[model samples]
Target: MNRKTLALSAVIGLLAPVLAGCGGSDGGSGGEAIVVGTTDQYIATDEAIAPLDPAAAYDTGSWNVLRQTIQTLMHVPRGGGKPIPDAASKCAFTDRANESYRCTLREGLKFAGGDPITADDVKYSFERVLKINDPSGVAGLLTNIDTMESDGAREIVFHLKTPDATFPYKLSTPPAGIVSKKDYEPTKLRKGFDVSGSGPYTFKAEVKGDTVTKATFTKNADYTGELNVQNNKVELQPFTDADEMGKALDSGDIDVMTRAMTPEQVESMVEKPKEGIQLTEMPGLEIRYLGFDTDAPTVKEKAVRQAMAYTIDRGDLVTKVYGSVAEPLYSLIPSSIATHTNSFFNKYGDRNLTKAADLLQTAGIATPVKLSLNYTTDHYGEATAKEFETLKDQLNSSKLFEVSIKGTEWKSFRPNQIKGDYSVYGMGWFPDFPDPDSYIAPFLDKDNFLNTPYNNAKLRGELIPQSRREADRSAATNTFSQIQDIVADDVPVLPLWQGKQYVASRDDIAGVEWAVNSSAELLLWELRRGPGAS
Candidate 1:
């Protein structure tokens, strides 16, 4: 990374208080140890990882855990860099056009059942995904793929219909995970007990929502370090709440805890050291925002939307609700990354309730330009209600508008936001892929999941596709910066803050440190029960 990139990392370091000196206890108390806790329950989201076939995969919280068990064709590291091979042994570009590509497979690789890994499996993964055409289908990744054929028993070549420079990086995403061709048949799907894959770890059992899911890794005796990180074994247990996760970690019931602990939780843990708890920090790609549904009649008026944007006190929200663990965001792109520009903050800084009222008055907003605010009840935390409550107070007290807040579970909150259900809502995005494109395309792209029936001719016509179509991404930086400014002026989806990825692990569990991308997916190989642990 250049100085600019390094400086960005430093800024993130200054902003990350979520996991700074975080820990509640040490590991190992002898009673069925190695439990893990999360904020959400596992819902059927991934077809490969979901309980049944015929379902599609989307980047949901529930699917995150499952994707870890299944290996993707490639994975992007935390810091800014190229994609690394995860499933395939070696992938290369065949045509100079950056369209056609071929990937060589690793020899002697076996699934949990010892099925030989082949190039056909790689071909089937994406083709089958397009065949199902799941509503949230990741077909966008394969836009240039005309056909995928095996060059040899161990090699696969993807012939593209157009020049697609991003194909290599796109293949690295989880949606592009290699599936077993034998397991996946034309007439049926593989979603049930046939959950098998060739990874460093094997899924022994998955006890749905309870405290039991064991993935045993016997060092892959046949493996010669295709997977850089390898562990003796892995044990996973899921807990639903932060309090439960924290208590479990505190009492040495589990090896690690996450998302469950709030900013205050870290502070408390840091202040009073517990037995086996030790906290460390890593960078992450998580971004949280307060989305404004422009489809709402009231918000369609730029003045009202601008006022709503201006009225929000992002700093106070960060300090009060997030316990200073989050940093204020000005655009959809996060500050830690290069594509980010503080356009929103530059335009709308320091919640100015007085100016917000003036803007509403100048726009001649009539009595009760009422707005329906929505949020996910269980996803963020107990304080989520209070955050929106604060939003309601600021806007209502500004006399610009009246706000009514409602809460729903995440499962509902996701689909509704894509459908533009409420006037405004609070939702966060953990990048499906690490690229800046991940953030911009998902929300602003007209064809994306957040359908956003938006007609931003400028963004759609120029900024996005232009960048993706070109071979050199840096050439499009100016266009993206322009997009940021346009997005700031439009105020359709207002980004509130970006939170650092955090983990509250036992002090004994060594090597459980943070990643730059702050990838929450715990690599068993990177984690070992330390001398302090057992």
Candidate 2:
């Protein structure tokens, strides 16, 4: 939502049909190969699309398939909750203690360029990420990887510094995908326009800086592994903008939509289904937030932060701005994952201007304590901006604070944030993994996820490392509860509503059930011009 390439949401430009309908397209009905339409274009790649380089991929929609079309030694299968294979067909804990793990590659598995997907390739891909050392450390979703060693042609071993129970889940991500050392020479920077990978589908047309497209994939008969789907072709058309995607979906441009749809778009699809259109709703990994620049003079006061939290009406924002599509978020950790808390609801259910004013007074915040809120205007569009305005009006009308709202494109939001340029800001997070650790890790720890440079003595010194020390993370619930308490009390980043996950598809587009990371993947292998398709 940080980039706005489409104006349909704001301008109300009906470039395509506006209606909602649904049914099923039988694979029984055949025509030319199905041509799905997309309203949004794939976000252009600065180079070729390659999951080989961690620095090269992270955006959700565009990255998911590229992450898939590329292979990893092990993958996290939906519902299985365990690691399966792509490069490594068979794997085991040779040590029996689950301390050291090894895997054997499937013979004949080769890159699109025909290079054997060797253990050395697997080692190179990982060591290279450590070498690049991406500052954001977002790549660390699979980090602390200690060392990856190759045992000749078919096998690879992983030695961890500690017993990581979530190791399999880590391998399930795109950042952990395997790559060819021959193709990804760690010594030189990669030009991704034409990269090598071994997945079900291979790249066809790549418009660098805009899109990388895969046409049809003939079955990789060699890939007789644990996965679903039989079709040989699929299209991964992605865009940085959500509205444009809505338009593209509305227009007959792409057959499937990989992101959450706006309420208006959802309404349209609800009205139609047989004309190659449909919608799928599920819980998502992404969570939007209201962050406070902890470095700011105003945000440092606990009462001010609490006042801000109490005064804003999330229900109104959901009804008016989100069209009640997204669920109201009362806690930072969403229920879709696990062990989420309804702390905010427990604290403040209805908006109370009087309570906020009293808290402000206790914190010495006199009337009209002028503050500015910043967000990415075009990213989430008019709806997001409207919500911010509603929040601003709520805070200002209390007579204890004055508020202003502003924005920038996501392309520039990062740098400004790093500089600590705003007092209050709007932010969002799509989990890097499916755990509570993912929810807590990125925000704090002095490294600065928000650039606010927050340091909570309790969190950094206590809860974090305690959770990391335990392999059975669910057992660390008591620690996370304390962490949540500190987070709520400190209020560096306040929890906002969680956006619902949605994917609008032409019934023919199959194989996308809820992904662990909450992505909608349309691999050609899982689809054919089937029932309820356009």
Measured by TM-score, the strongest candidate is 1
Expressed as tens digits, the lDDT of each residue in 239-325 for candidate 1 is 556777777766777776766467777677667655556555556566777677676786778888788778888887777777656
Clashes of 2: 46
Candidate 2 segments whose C-alpha is farther than 4 A from its true place: 1-20, 23-52, 91-99, 185-195, 208-225, 238-251, 271-276, 378-382, 445-452, 468-473, 512-525, 531-534
Candidate 1 wrongly placed segments (more than 4 Å): 1-33, 44-55, 77-80, 144-146, 159-165, 185-194, 204-225, 353-355, 358-364, 469-473, 514-517, 532-534
RMSD of each: 4.2, 7.2
lDDT of 2 by residue, 1-534 (tens): 100111011212211222235544332223434433332333333332343345445445435445546677776555324457766788766654445778898888777756667787777777776676454454555555677889898888888755555566566566566666766667553554443477665655556544444433344544434666456555555465567776666565666665545676665556544454556665455678888777688777778888888887777777877764677787777655445677676776658887887878887777677789898754444466778888888788777678888878654554566567787889877665556766777787544345457788778666776666555556766777777767776777888787755566555654434322342333345455554333
Residue 231 lDDT (model 1)? 47
Candidate 1 overall lDDT versus native: 0.63
- lDDT of the candidates, in the order given: 0.63, 0.61
